[model samples]
Target chain A: MSMDFGGLRAVDRLDLMIHRGEIVALIGPNGAGKTTFFNCITGLYTPTEGDIHIHPPGGGSKRINGLKPNRVTELGLARTFQNIRLFQQMTVLENVMIGRHCRLRSGIAGAVFRPPHTVSEERQAAMDSYRILEKIGLESFVNDLAKNLPYGAQRRLEIARALATEPFLLLLDEPAAGMNPHETHELDQLILRLRETENVSILLIEHDMKLVMSLSDRIYVMDYGRKIAEGAPGRIKNDPVVIKAYLGEEYVA
Target chain B: MTPLIEIRKSVLVSIWFMFLTFPIMVIRVNTVENVVEWRWHNMIAIGAGSFLLSFVWRYMIRRKEQGIRRQREGAGPRLSIFQRIGQERRIFLPALTLLAVAVVVFPFLVSMYQVNIMTTAFMYIMLGLGLNIVVGVAGLLDLGYVAFYAVGAYTYALLNHHFGLNFWVCLPIGAALGAGFGILLGFPVLRLRGDYLAIVTLGFGEIIRLVLENWNEFSFGPSGISNIPRPGLFGVAFSLEAHARYIYFIVVALAVFTIFMVNRLQNSRIGRAWLALREDEIACQAMGVDKTRTKLTAFALGATWAGLAGVIFAAKTTFINPASFTIWESINILCIVVLGGMGSITGVVLGALVLVLLPEYLRAFAEYRILTFGVVLVLMMVFRPGGIVSNVRRTYQFEGPDSGDK
Candidate 1:
């Protein structure tokens, strides 16, 4: 898919496909348009040229080009922003509960004068959100305001919130940007556990090569808006184009 | 800094205020009487007020910073006074009981005039709480809220004038019409935010008032519909005093209902959606909240309350005019939502009472009401900008997986 803004092309004629439960890392230099690509797929910006489609396991492939961000989420695609666009004033539980919004059916009548079904649905959503929090290991901070969370916990909360959507595909932008090594290690484990247990595909944008190499089943490297290399981590680590554009020559083996 | 420095700074502030007010306060041209009046005593009052006010401002600022500093330093979060009261039902219940007793007896104990004033206060409380849903929780800065109020009022007036419908029958119809108008306003301004949204709503309020003023065929062209029947009790006739007391009870009941509904809504699924929408539009949508639906719902619901209150207003006054539903009415309601505490039902209630009633009790009440309101708002901005009360979220206790919903 190609996305152009005025004279600038943010994501150039590129094609990406994720299997049902594969963990893929999209590694690129700054402004290489990984986040832009995520935005395109998630319907924040419609691709200028190509089509975006999602196939939810048993469902037929449905085109999602130019749909609103919320509709893309409803189509089983969820993403976390590069700068963490959490509802800062809300509690961790409420944040995740919002992720459950598209799945539940409730309107003004259901909200104001909740019937038994609505009540049960709300309770189930909360319980499901709490279980997601437990899986992501943010249950302790469940009641804390999103703004007050420590940097690493906030990142995990974003993932936990995304997980609450029960999406078939998850897009995480620079999820480990501010995390310490220990926290990164934990996140790697969490991502793997998510793939194994939650049965959701993950497309991550990461700068931490070590975490990326360990966590990703495959890596797609990009430079300036075009995909430069697509291969296993070992192959990408030694690619001349990737070395010149992103990873230094000295590290190329 | 030092005590001496603080005093010097306050002196400078007082001097600055005096200079600022010199032209407006100290010098007044009497255009009709043909005299240039110099009121020197006005300068004295201004100087003294600013000097004392400056110290209080400085102290409040320091205290606010200290609270933030403590929070940042990981010094165990300190709950606000309201939050503490909410936590300990012992303090909350009795305070609630006393207020309930006061509301129950206030009309009977007071003169008809005072009861009438209290009824007005109740109307404002309803307006404040309603606007609180839009401007406070949903984070939509709607300036045309009075448009819905106007809709409610006109709904009752016109329906009664034509069909001879009474207040009780018109109440729901008025509210539904208000919600319809709300959606009408909501659809156009769905994409707008902050200042832009405020401007559109402001324009909307003007449009409604203008329509009422010029619609000679329908609205009677601003002379207003008068002699509208008071809300009757199963067609029972009453003395003017009895009607006043009866309307007071109806309003109080309605006000209490609004509070209960608002309180319940603030904790529900849609309430959470509204709060989410208020904080960040993109993030809320990404969480699968339909932005269009959420915005419209907030508009419709908030307008619903204003409509309910507007019906009561027409029945009480036995009159209606475009003048009553001006933009200032919207601003007055907005101020209550803001100064009382956005997103806090209790804060809106407190704000309505303080802003509405305090003026009536003050000396030279009519002349000083606006001035007092301005000074209080300025002080509030400088001091407790979050409002008199901050919203405290209800926490759900965590139990093990085996346990059911508690």
Candidate 2:
């Protein structure tokens, strides 16, 4: 699926498919419309041109354009922001718990009265939040305020929050943007583990070519909102257009 | 123990002992003619109370530090549903039960003068809770909440005095009027945020009061409307002759009901939405919260409570005046919400009771009362910015989709 932004063509018509259990990275130069494509897919912007389809686990495809971000999330697609958007004032656990809000059925009456069902649902959500926190090495920080975490931890917390949403497909925008080399190396491993252990599809937008090449199963390169190249990471690494648009032609093999 | 630790422990014990002794001392020393003398006793009691309280406070701080250390060592108490529920229940249920008991028996234990003071306190509680719904939960600063109060009062007064409508009949009319005014106020300021919204709401409140004062043809001007009927129980007046205490009971009932509803709303989806808005409006919008509708609901719900309080206020006083609802009144209610701790129901209740009842309790200090109130509020802000109950915290957990967090 693809998106068009008026005559400027921010996200030009492009076809892409993300299979289950695969990690795909979309990379390009600045103003390459990589993030714009993300915004369109995440429902922050509606595609003026084409249809983006999401296939749920139950064997049905749903058109995702023009839906609200939360509605899109409800259909089993969750995302992390380029800049961390965890609820800062809430605790780490609370931030993750909010992602489970779509699944929880305890209304106002149930919360106040706290009946059997409410208790069980709340119990389940709490357990789920803890498991995710544990997975992200954030179990000890469960009670810490989101804002209190170190920058690297904050980034990890954002991913943990997205994971808590229970999406079949996770969209990550620049997860390693501000990370040091060591942290980025660790994040690469974390992304690989997420795909292998969790068995979820991932669509990533990254500027770090090394990290992208190492982690992605497939790569789609864009320039000025148009897909300039698409192939396996090895093929895309030497593609002339991809190198010219992003890594500079001189660096191409 | 180290000398420092020993001192802290001593201080904590003393403060706890003093808190336990305070009410007993107050009851023993309270006198009709020399209420200001009671203030000195309070000072002594608080001195002793603080000594014990500080020790406990220090101990708790140390305990928290130890807990954090344990967490870093992977030995902290694992997050559990039972434990979380127990913690919340411990904080909420006891306070609730205490308030419930107080409301049930207050009229029987107090004199008529005390009953009147209690009624006024109840009004302030209603106002604080109402404003809390907007400012605390929804994070909307509304300086014009008093306008809704005025609208409700005027609605009841005008309808009752001019058309001979009963108090009960006019109560709903007053609520409807307040809700209408609230929605109208919300529309114009929907795009405004933070301090800008505050200024507009302040102006809106002032505008309402000024209109009520100047529009004599309708509001009867500064003289205000007189002979507004009091509410009756099943058509029976709760007067001095029949059962004056019944009116106090009614006020107590209304206060309790308001507390119940506010607590419920605070825990519901709408309550969560309001808190989400308070934390971050842009993110709330991104999360699909209808900003305009959420804000309007807050205003309307808050106004509805204020209107109900107005009914009680009108009926209790049996008279109405534009002077009753003023900017100062709004400030006082706002102060209660802040002093009690924003988003804390129990905190607001305690704050309202103390702020409203302290003046009546210290009638002899009438000249210095406002000065003391101002000093106390400033000190509270400086020393305890999170209000009286800062230690209370909320935690959340999320499990994976396939395997529930539990």
Candidate 3:
């Protein structure tokens, strides 16, 4: 996908492929267009060229170019934000419940009058959200406002919220931006467990090299709005281009 | 906590209060004689009283905060009275039942005048709830809500006046027209946010009012359709007292239904979508909530309540005019929503009652009603911006591990 901002190309002809259940990590220095690429895929921004093809688990692949952000989410692809864009005023459970927005089939009549079917569906959705919260170890903060949560928990809540959408391909943008070592370790295990148990694919953008190197099945490196290196952890760790552009000369020696 | 700092805070608060109260408390207008009288005695009394009150209040708040800080350092948590009431499940149903019974009995115990006032208050409550859906829940700042009210009122008036239809027939027609207008007005302003949305809505309201005033064809121009027909109770002609009581019950029932519907919506998936949209439009869209559909639903749902209230209002007054559905009317309804914490059903109810009835009780100062309202609203913004009954955080029955709903 190629994305241009007037004369500047934010993302320039970057091609990435993540197979089902594969943990892919997209790493780049600040302003290398990692987030811009994610934006292109998520429909937050329309790519100037190239197409975003989503192959749903049930089969059939479709080019999702110029679709709305909500349409992208409904196609079994969900993502968290780089800066933790949570519904700060809403409670934790409500935040997670919103993740089930596309899945639920309730309308105005269902919401206002609340027939038995709608009520049952609502209850089931609540239970599903609660279960997701429990899995993320945020059951304790269910009633707490999303803003009131501690930094680490808030990040986890965002992940839980995304997971509630039951996405086949989950994209996380800087999920470990403000986490401590312990929290990062916990997140690593959580991501691994999600892949193992749920068979979900994860594409994460991260600056934390240690977490990235440990969690990613494959690493794709980008710099100056272009992919510089793409390979397994061992191979990319020693790649000359990646070492010069990102990892630095010290790591290569 | 130095006395000097404490005194400085108190003085600042006093100065603020003095400026806020000066116009309303110190100056009295003699509307009958068309003269403004300066009440020096009243000014001095009020100024000194405010200063003293501010001093005491500042000291008390400081002491309370310090105490809370110390407690926070030592304890797990402490629930405030509001939180306690909000969380305690056992007390909730009984309290609600008592309030419900009181509401049913209120009209019978009060005088006819009081009953009429209460009915008006209920209408405002209904309007407030409707606006709350747009402003509080959907985070759409609509300044033209009275347009929908006007549509409903006009729908009823024109139908009853032109076709000789009864209130019952007009009621549904009014509601449908109200919803239709809501969607109609909502479409153009779908992409507008914040002040722009407010401006568009305000303009829409003025347009509706102007259309009613100048048309002279359908709405009877500015004179309005008189004798719009009062609602009947199964073919029985109600006397004056009975009529007041009758209107009171109808409005009360409508208000109760609105509250029930709003409350249910607040907890439902659609309610969550509206709130999410309000909280963050991008996030809501990312979560797969269709922006157009959600916004239109919010507008339609909110307007439905206002339309019902409008029909009731016309039936009770037995008259209508373009003058009644002004921008000020929209502001009055908006005031109730904001004054009663936004997104709170109970808050809107309390806000409507206080805003509508307080003016009636202050009949002696009736000339200063608008001035007093402005001051009160300003004070509310400064002190408790959330409102009189701010929205409490809600937890579903199925939230806890040992929850019976499981």
Most accurate candidate by TM-score: 1
Candidate 2 local lDDT, B1-406, one digit each (tens): 5878877777666666666766655455437775433344674767666776666666776776776688789775444443354468786688658867977777778777877888889888988999989988788998878888988888888888788888778878888887788898999999899999999999999999999999989899999988776777777644573344666777677778888888877765567667777887655544445567778888988887788788778877878888888998899889888888787777788789888988777777878877787777876876567775442434333334454432
- Model 2 alpha-carbon miss at residue A46, Å: 5.2
- Tens digits of per-residue lDDT, candidate 1, B1-406, equal 9999999999999999999999999999999999999999999999999999999988988998998899889887677887888779899999889989998988888899899989999999999999999999999999989999989999999999999998889999999999999999999999999999999999999999999999899899889999988999887889999899999999999999999888878778889999999988988988789999999989999999999999999999999899999888999899899889889888899899988887777646678877886787898876778778865456444464555253
TM-score of each: 0.93, 0.74, 0.89
Q: RMSD to native for every prediction?
A: 2.8, 9.3, 3.9
Per-residue C-alpha lDDT of model 1 across residues A108-212, encoded as one tens digit per residue: 677678899988888888889889998998888877889989999999999988888889999999999989999999999999998999889999999999999
Best by DockQ: 1
Off by over 4 Å in 2: A1-22, A30-33, A45-66, A111-116, A134-140, A180-186, A193-199, A223-227, A247-253, B1-111, B158-192, B203-224, B241-244, B285-297, B359-369, B394-406
Give DockQ per model, in order: 0.62, 0.22, 0.57
Sequence-dependent TM-score of model 2: 0.74
Query: Which residue runs does candidate 3 get wrong by more than 4 Å?
Result: A247-253, B1-54, B57-98, B397-406
| lDDT of all predictions | 0.89, 0.79, 0.86
Worst 10 residues of 3 chain B by lDDT: B397-406
Q: Candidate 2's C-alpha lDDT?
A: 0.79
What is the CA-based DockQ of model 3? 0.57
lDDT of 2 by residue, A1-253 (tens): 5566555778778777899998999988888888788888777888887899988888988998998777777787778878778678777877777677667767656856778887777777778878888898888888788888999899998888778778888899899989999999989989888887787899999999899999998999888778889889999987787768766767766
Better of 2 and 3 by DockQ: 3
In model 1, which runs have C-alpha deviations exceeding 4 angstroms? A247-253, B1-3, B10-81, B363-366, B395-406
